[model samples]
Target: MQDTTDFEVWIEDNEPDGYEEIYTLYRSVAEREDNGIWAVTTNGDKTFVTGPTSTLQLLSEKARRTFLNAVEALKSDPEMDMESWYGYERNMANSKA
Candidate 1:
């Protein structure tokens, strides 16, 4: 079985698709007991499952770039007051709602 570290790298690189594929590769290491939790790290870090595993495979490189940019923005502005990142996302969600 591949480790979590390797799987993380794989996802960042290949971005495999299909629930069965993801489950096969990541289920043992990443599956969470909680209903809302999709994957949890050994260190207890958590990331929500944004969509179906197949959706992840279909994500465009441009979308990945945008996501990385957002992560960079959040990291560069760790002080919440410096950048209301969560607020921006909340507003975006509200607007969509």
Candidate 2:
């Protein structure tokens, strides 16, 4: 997880206009990543899932579902079970398909 400092830097870089601003920040970080794919916006009910399409396409169907659910649990579902949330991401990363 990113620290408060990293989020502060992003806010300083641009006004938090909407999901596009969030996507720009996500893209910058994603470009540096070599593995894994997942995303979510932070706009209340208007929020949506997002991420690099190419990276997501590389995932197997099961992996894609796991990754997406993991991200959602982390970013959006505060009520989700902690054990389930972390295990899903761990397995998604370890899985070959």
The number of the candidate with the highest TM-score is 1
Worst 10 residues of 1 by lDDT: 49-58
Q: Model 1 off-target regions past 4 Å?
A: 7-10, 13-35, 41-83
TM-score of each candidate structure, all chains considered together: 0.26, 0.24
Worst 10 residues of 2 by lDDT: 50-59
Deviation of model 1 at 46, angstroms: 14
lDDT of 1 by residue, 12-46 (tens): 54453433333333332233222221333232243
What is the per-residue lDDT of model 2 for residues 1-97, given as tens digits with 9 covering 90 to 100?
A: 2222222342433333333333333443333232233343332222222333211221233433443343333332356454454455455657673
The lDDT for every candidate, in the order shown, is: 0.35, 0.35
- Residue 16 of model 2 has an lDDT of 31
